[model samples]
Target chain A: MEATKKNSWLTENRRSAIAAYLFISPFFILFAIFGLFPMLFSFYLSFFRWDGLDPMTFNGLDNFRFIFSDPIFYSSIQNTFIIGLLGTLPQIVVSLLIAFALNSSLIRFRNTFRTLIFLPYITSIVAVAIIFGLVFNNQPFGFANYILSLFDGGPIRWAAEYWPVKFAIATMVFWRWVGYNTIIFLAGMQSIPRELYEAAKIDGASIGQQLRLITLPMLKRIVMFVVFTATIGSLQLFTEPLIFLGRGLREEGITVVAYLWRDAFVYNTFGTASAAAIVLFVIIITLTAINLALSNLIGRSKRRVS
Target chain B: MSTKEVGEGKFSIKKFFVYLVLVGAGLISLFPFYYMFVMSTRLNREINSVPPPFTPGNNLVENFQKVTDSIDFFGSMWNSVIVSSTITFGTLFLCSLAGYAFAKLPFKGKKVLFALILVTMMVPPQLGLIPQYYIITTLGWLNDFRAIIVPGLINAFGIFWMRQYIEDGVPYEIVEAAKMDGCSNFRVYWNVVVPMILPAFATLGIIVFMHVWNDFLWPLVVLRDPSVHTLQVALRALNDAREMDYGMIMSGTFWATVPLIFVFLLFNRLFIQSLSEGAVK
Candidate 1:
C-alpha cells in the first residue's frame, strides 16, 4: 500500500512539472524563433553583404573595416554622445529636484501635479517630434523664435545649424523623459523610512541637510538605476532625431540607431548596418559596465563616509 | 521667542517656494499639448503668423477636414486599436500564465529559465532588428499586422513583472489545496490564480496597451503599405511624405493623442500608483 501511494505521488509531482513546462512553453518557443534566433542571426549577418533582394556575399571583416574608416560613422557616434549628454545630465538634476519638490511636506493636489508632469511621457514620440519641429521651425514666426523675440533676439536656424539641431532634439528628449525619471525618483523617495527624517530633524538637521545626508545616500541604488537606464536609452535614441531632423537632411541630429536605419533602408547596406548595430551593442555593454563600476565606487565611498 | 517665530516664518516661505516650483513645472509640462490644440484650431497661414496664435481660432473644422482628406485617419486609428488590443490581451494572458508557473509550480529548470528572462530584459531589442526583419520577410509576414502582433505577444519584462506579482500576491497553500481537490495545474491557474491576480493583469494591461499604442519604429519598418499603416506611421506620412500643412498635421496630432489622454485622465491614479509600485520592486 505504501509503495502504491508513493508511486501515485511521484506521478502527481511529475504531472505538475509537465504542466508547468507546458504553461511556460509559449514564451520560450516564441522567444527562440523571434528573439534569440534573430540576435544570433544578426551577428551572422554582420559578415555578409546583402541588399534585401540580392544574394548575400560573405565579406568577412570588410564591413567592419569600412565602418572604422568611415568618417560619417564617427560623426554619428559623436552626435549620439553629444545629444545623449545634452539630454541626460540636465534631465537627471531637474527630475530629481522635481521629485523632491513633489515629495515635500504639505503639498496639495500631488496626484494632479504628477499626472500633469507625466502627461508628456505617454504622448507618442512621433507626435512630440512633429509638434516640437514646428515649435523650433526655422521660420521667423516659429514658436521658439517668438520667445526669442521677447528678448530682442532674431530668428535662429533651429533645424539647419548643428548645435541648434542637437539642442532641439535634446529638448524634445528632455521634455518627454523628465517626468518619467521624476516619478521613479519620487517612488524611491517614498520608500525611504520616515523615521530617518524624523531622527534627522531631532538632531537639528535642516531640510536641505536631511535631503543631502540621508535621502541622497539612501537612494543611491535607485539613482544609479535611473542613470543606467537613461544612459542606455539615450544611446539608442532614434525616432526623435529621425522625425525632428526629417529625412535626407544630413550632418545633424543623426543618432547611431538612426544612422543604422538609414544605412540599411536608404543606402541599402545591410552588412554595414549590421556592423553598426554590433558596434552600438558593444558601446551599450561597455557603458553598462562602466556605470556598474561607478555605482559600486559610490557605494564604497558612502560606506566609508558613514 | 523671536527666533522661534522667525523659524516658523521661514517654514511657510519654503512651503510657498515648493508649491511654486511644482505648479511652474506642471505648466511647462502642459504647454506643448496646449500648443498642439491651439495650432490645430488655426489656419495654416495663422499658424506661422508672427507671435503665433496662442488661442483657438475658427479654423478647427477646416483643419479637421484637411486631416481626414490627407490620410485615412480613422482607418489607421482602427488599425492601431486592433494591433494594440491584440498584443495587450495576448501578452497579459501568456505572461501571467508563465509568471504563475514560474512562481507557484515546482518546475524543472525554473531557476535557469527565470534568470534567462532577467538577462533578456537587459539586452535591447534593436540588437536583433536586421535578422528579425529578414525573418519576417522570409515568413512573408511583411505588411501584415501579425508581423508586429506575433513578435510582441509576450515580452521578457512582462513575464518578469507578473512573476514578481504572483510570488507576492498568490499563496502556495491555495495552489496545493486546489490540486489536492483534483484540480489540474492549468485548471487551478485558470480558476484560482487568474481572478486573484486581476490587479496585476490590469496594471500590466495598461502598461502594454500604452506602449503598443505609442510604438512607432517596428510598425514603421514592417507596416510600410499605406492601407495597413498604424496611426503613428500615418501621422508620420502626413508630416513628411505627404503634405506640409501645419494645420493638418497638428489636427492629426491632436486626434491621435486624444484617445490616450482620455484613458490617462480616467486612470491617472492607477497609472501613477502602478509606476511607483513598479519602481519599488
Candidate 2:
C-alpha cells in the first residue's frame, strides 16, 4: 500500500511539472524564434556583406573596419552624446524640482496637476514631432521664434541650423519625458520616511537644506535609476530626429540609430548596419557599466561624508 | 510672538512662489496640445499670420475633411485599433499564464527560466531590429499585421512584471486550495488566478495598447502598402506629402491623439496611480 501511494505522488508531481512547462512554453518558443534568434543572427550578419538581393560574401572584420573609418559614423556618435546631454541634464534637474513642489503640502488638486503634467507623455512621438515641427519652424512666424522676438532676439532658423536643430530635438525629448521622471521622483520621495523630515524640522532645517541633505541622500538609488535609463534612452534616439529631419541623412541631426537605419534600409548595406548595431550595443553596455560604477562611488563618498 | 508672525509671512511668500512655479509649469506643459487644437481650426495662411493663431478658427470641419481626403485617416485609425487591441489582449493572456507558472507552480529550472527573462529585459530590443526585420521578410510576413502582432504578443518585461504582480497579489494558499478541489492548472489560471489579478491585467493591457499604437519605426519598416499603413505611418506620409498644410496635419494629429486622451481623462486617477506604482516597483 505504501509503495503504491509513493508512486502515485511521483506521478502527480510529474504531471504538475508538465503543466507548468506548458504554461510558460509560449514565451520561450516565441522568444527563441523572434528574440534570441534575431539577436544571434545580427551578430552573425555583422561579418558578411549582403544587400538583401545578392549572395552574401564573407568579409571578416571589414564591416567593423569600414564603420571605424567612416567620418559619418564619428559624427553620428558626437551628435548622439551632445543631444543626449542637452536633453538629459535639464530633464533630471527640472523633474526633481517639480517633484519637490508636488510633494509639498501646499499643493491642492495634486492628481489634477499630475494628469496635466503627464499628458505630454501619453501622446505619440509622431504627433509631437509634427506639432513641434511647426512650433519650431524655420520661418519667422514660428511660435518659438515669436516668443524669442518678444525678448528682442532674432528669428533663428530652428530646424535647419546646427545648434538650433539639436536644441529643438532635445526640447521635444525633455517635454515628453519630464513628467515621467517627475512621477518616478515623486514616488521615490514618498517612500522616504517621514521621521527623517520631522527630525530635520526639529533641528530647524529649511526646506532647501532638507532637500539637499536628507531627501537627496535618501533618494540616491532612484536618482541613479532614472539617470541610467535616460542615458540608454538618449543614446537610442531615433524617431524625433528621423521625423524632424526626414528620412534622408541630415549631418546636423542624424543619430547613431538613424545612421544604422539608413545604412540597412536606404543604403542596402545590412552587414555594415549590423556592425553599427553591435557597436551601439557595446557603447550602451559600457555606458551603463560606467553609470553603475559612478553611482556606487557617489554612494560611498556620501556615506563617508555622513 | 512678533518674530513668529514675521516667520509665518516669509513662509507664505515662499509658498506663493512655489504655487506660481507649479501653475506656470502646468500651462507650459499643456500649451502644445492647445496650440495643436488651435492650429487644426485655422487654414495654412491663418496659421502663418504675423501673430500665430492662438484661438480656434472656423476651419475645423474643413481640416477634418482635408485629413481624410489626403490620406486614409480613418482606415489607419482602424488599423491601429486592430493592432493595438489584439496585441494588448494577446500579451495579457500569455504573460499572465507565464507569470502564474513562474510565481506559484513548482517546476524544475524555474529559477533559471525566470533569471533568463530578467536578463532579456536588460537586452535592448533595438540590437536585434535589423535581423528581426530580415526574419519577418524571409517568412513573408512583411506588410502583414502578424509581423508586428506575433513578435510583440509576448515580451520579457511583460512576463517579469506579471510575475512580480502575481507573486505579491495572489496567495499560495488559494492556489493550493484550488488544486485540492481537483482543478486543472489551466482552469486555476483562467478561473481562480485571473480574477484575483484584474488590476495587473488592466495595467499591462493599457501599457501594451499605448506602446503598439504609438509605435512608428517597426510599422514604417514593415508596412509598406498605403492601405495597410498604421496611423503613425500614415501621419508621417501626410506630413511628408503636404508639408505646408498645417491645419490638415494638426487635424490628423488631433484625431489620432483624441482616443488615448479621452481614455486617459476617463481613468485619470487610475492611470496616475497605477503608472507611478509601476514605476516605483
Candidate 3:
C-alpha cells in the first residue's frame, strides 16, 4: 500500500510538469520562429552584400564601411538626435510638471483632463501627420502661420526647411507622447506614501520645497526609466516623418528607421539596410548603458546626501 | 482641498495663474483635434481661406463620399478590426496561460525561461527588419494579416505583466486545494485563476487593442495588396496614390480616430489605474 501511494505521487508530479510546459510552449515557439531567428539572420546578413533579388556575396565589413562613408546615413543620425532631443527633454520636464499639477488638489475634472490629453497619443500617427500637414501648410493663411502673425511673424514655412521640419516633427512627437509620460509620472507620484507628504506639511515644507526635496528624488528611478524608453523610441522614429513628407520626399525630417525603410524598399539595398540596423542597434545599447550608469550615480549620490 | 495652502500664503493671484496655466495647457492639447474636425468638414478651397474656417464647415458628406470612393476605406477598417481583435484575444489567452505557469507552477528551467523572456524585451525588433521580412516571405505570409497579427500575438511584455498579476492576485493555497480535489491544471486556471484576474485581462486587452490598431510599420511591410491593407497602411496609400482633397484625407483621419476615442473614453479610469498601478509597484 505504501509503495502504491508513492508511485501515484510521482505520477502526479510528472503529469503536472508536463502540463506546465505545454502551457508555455506557444510563446516560445512563436518567439523562436519570428523574433529570434530574424534577429540572428539580420546579424549574418549585415556582413554580406546583396540587394533583395540578387545572389548574396559574403563581403566582410564592406556594408559597415560603406555606411561610414554614406553622407545620408550621417545626416539621418543627426536628424534623429536633433528631433529626439527636441522632443524628449521638454517632454520629460513638462510631463513631470503636469503630473505634479494633476496630483495637486486645485485641479478639477482631473480624470477628464488626463483622458483628453492622452487622446492624442492613442490617435493614429498617420492621422496626426496628415492633420498637422494642413495646419502647417506654409501659405499666408495657414493655421500655424496665422497664429504666428499675431506676433508679427510672417509665414514660418513650418515644413519647408530643415530646422522647421525638425521643429514640426518635434512638435508632433511632443504633442503625441507628452501625455503618455505624464500619466506614467503621475502614476509614480500617486504611489508615494501620503504620510510622508503630511509629515512634510507639518514641518511647513512648501510645495516647491517638497517637490525638490522629496518628489524629484523619489522619482529618479521612474524618470530614468522614462528617459530610457524615450531614448529607445526616438532612436527608432520612422512613420511620422515618412508620411509627413508625403511619401516621395525623403529630404526633410527623415529618421534612421525611415532611412532604413527607404534604403531597403526604395533602393533595394538589403545588405546596406541590414548594416544600418546593426549600427542603430549598437547606438541604442551604448546609450542605454550610459543612461544606466548615470542613473546609478544619481541614485547613489541621493542616498549619500540623505 | 487642504493642499491649496501647501506653499502659498493664501488664496491669491498665484492660484488664479495656476488654474489659467492648467486650462491653457488643456486647450492646447485639444486644439489640433478641434482643427482636425473643422478641416474634415470643409473643402480645401474653404480650408485655405485667409482666416481658415475655425468652425466646422458643411462639406462632411461630400468629403466622406470622396475618401471612401478613392480607396476601400471601409474594407480596410474591417481588416483592421479583424487583425486587432484577433491579436488582442489571442494575447490575453496565451499570455495569461504562460503567466500562470511561470508564476505558480514548479517546473524545470522556469527561472531560466523567464530570464530569457526578459532579455528578449530589450532587443528592439525594428533593427531586424530585413530578416524578419524574409521570414514572412519564406512562410508566404506577405500581404497576409497573419504576418502582422501572428508575430504580435505573443509579446514578452504581456507575459511579464500577466505573471505579475497571477503571482499577486491568486493565492497558492487555492491552486493546491484545487489540485487536491483532482482538478486538472487547465481547469483550475479557467475556473479560479481567470475569474480572479479579470481586471488584468481587461487592462491587457485594451492595451493590446490600441497597439494593434495603431501599428503601422509592420503592417506596411507585410500587406502589399490594397485589399488586405490595414487602415493606416490603406490611408497612406490613398494619400499617395490619389490626388486626394484635404477634406477627404481629414475625413479618413476622423474615421480612424473616432472609434478609439470612444473606446478610450469608456475605459479611461480603468486604463489609467492599471498603468499607474502596474508601473508603480
Candidate 4:
C-alpha cells in the first residue's frame, strides 16, 4: 500500500504541484505571520483597550468614541489634507512639465539630466528632513532667510508654526517625489504612439497645443494612478514631521501616523492608535476607489467622444 | 521668407525657455544635496554664522568624532547592511522561485494564487501600524533584527515583477527541453530559468535592496536598540542627541547617504530602468 501511494504521488501533475507548493510556501508563511496577522490584529485591537504590557480589557466603541472627540485628531486630519494638497498638486504639475520637457527633442544629455533629477529620491528621508531643517532654520543667516532678506522679508518660521511646519514637510515631500512622478509621466509619454505627435505637428499644432489636446487626455489613466497613490502616501506622512519637529507628539506638525505613533508608544494608548490606523486605512481605500471610478468615467467619455 | 525666419526665431526662444525650466528643476532637486554636503563639513558656529559658509569647513574630523562618540554608527550600518542584503537576496530567491512556478510550471491553483498575489499588490500596506507593534512584541521580536528582516523578505510586488519578467523574457522551449531530459522542477528552475533571467535579477536586486535600505517606518517600530538600528534610525538618534548641532547631524546624514548614492551613480542605467519599469503608473 505504501509503495503504491508513493508511486501515485510520483505522477507528473502531483509532482509539479508539490514542487510549486514548496516554491510558494515562503511568501505565504511570511505573509501569514507578518502581513495578514498584523492587519487582523490591528483591527481586532481597535475594539479592546490594552497598553503594551497589561492584559486587554474589552471596551466597546470606546476607542472610536475617543477619536471623535479628540480635537488633535481632527486637526491632524485637516493638517494632513492641507499638506497633501500643498505637496501633491505642485508635484503633479511640475513633474508633468519636466517629463514633457525631457521627452521633447530639444533636450540634450537626457540620461544625465534624468539621473541628477532623481538623486533626491534615493537619499534617506531622515537626512533630507534634517538638511531641510537647517536650511530653513528661522535665523538671520539661514539660506531661506538670506533669500528672504534679498526681498526685505524677515526670517520665516519654517518649522515653528503650524503652516510653516506643514509647508516645510510639503516641500520635503515635493522634493523627494517630484522626480519619481516625472519618470512615471515620461514612461507614460514614451508608451504613446509617435504617430500622434507627428500628426499634430503636421496639422500645425504648436507644442503647447499638442500637449493640451493629445498628451494630457492620453495620460488620464496615469494621472489617476498618481493621484490615488499620492493620496495614500500623503495620508500616512510621518517621518518628515517626526524628524522636523524634533519633539515627541508636538501639536504643530503631527500627522495622523505620527499621532498614531504617539498614542501607542508615547501615551501607551494602543487602542486609540489602532483605531486611527483603521480610520486612515479606510480613508485611503475610499479615496483610491473614488479615483478609479472617476478615471473609468473619463475613459468612457473619451471613448464616446472619439 | 521673412515670416519663416521670424517664426524660426520665435521657436528658438521657446526652446531656450524650456531648457531654462528643465535646468532650474534639476538644480532644485540637487541643491538640498549640495547643502547637505556643505553643512556636514561646517561646525555649528559656521553653519549659524551670518555669511553661512557655502564652502567646505575644516570641522570634518571633529564632526566625525562627535557622531561616532555618540552613536554606534558602524554597528548600526552593519545592521542595515545585514537587513537590506538579507532581504535583497531572500526576495530574489523566493520571488524568482514562485514567479518561475507561476509562469512556467503547470501547477494546480496557479491562476487563483497568482490573482491573489496581484490583488495584494494593488493596496498599500499602511493599515496595521499599531497592531503590527502588538504582534511583534507578542512574538517577543522587539529589538530583534529578524523582526525587521523576516517580515520584509516577501513582497507581492517583487513576485509580480519576477513573474512578468520571466513570462516575457524566458522562452518555454528550453524549459521543456530540460524537463524532457528528466530534470526535476526545482533543478530546471535552478539551472535554466535563473541563468536566463540575470538582467531581471539585477533589476529586482537593486529595487529590493533599495526598498530595504531606505525603509524607515517598520524598522523604526521594531528596532528600538541602538545596535540593531538602521542608518536612518541611527541618524535620528544622533540628531536628537546633538540637537541643533547641524555639523554632526549633517555629517552623519552625508555618510549614511553616500553608499546608496555611490551605488546609484555606478549603476544609474540599470537603476533608472528598474525605477521606470517598477513604476505603478
Model 4 ranges off by over 4 Å: A1-10, B1-10
Give me the displacement of residue A42 in model 4, in angstroms.
1.4
Q: Indicate the docking level reached by candidate 2.
A: medium
Candidate 4 lDDT tens digits, A149-200: 9799988887778888788889989999999899889889998897798778
lDDT of 4: 0.85
User: What is the per-residue lDDT of model 2 for residues B172-223, given as tens digits with 9 covering 90 to 100?
Assistant: 8998888777788889899899999999988877777888999998898899
Query: For each candidate, what is chain B's TM-score?
Result: 0.95, 0.94, 0.94, 0.93
lDDT of 1 at A192: 88
Q: Residue A188 of model 2: what lDDT?
A: 90
The order of the candidates by DockQ, greatest first, is: 1, 3, 2, 4
Which numbered prediction scores highest in TM-score against the true structure? 1
lDDT of each: 0.88, 0.88, 0.85, 0.85
Quote model 2's TM-score: 0.95
Candidate 3 Cα errors over 4 Å, as ranges? A1-5, A198-204, A302-306, B1-9, B242-244, B278-281
Measured by DockQ, the strongest candidate is 1
Predictions' DockQ, in order:
0.67, 0.64, 0.66, 0.62
CAPRI band for model 1: medium
Candidate 2 collision pairs: none
Candidate 1 residue A69 Cα shift, in angstroms, is: 2.2
Tens digit of per-residue lDDT, candidate 3, span B24-77: 668878998898898889997887678779899899899889888888999999
What interface RMSD does each of the candidate structures achieve?
A: 1.9, 2.0, 1.9, 2.2
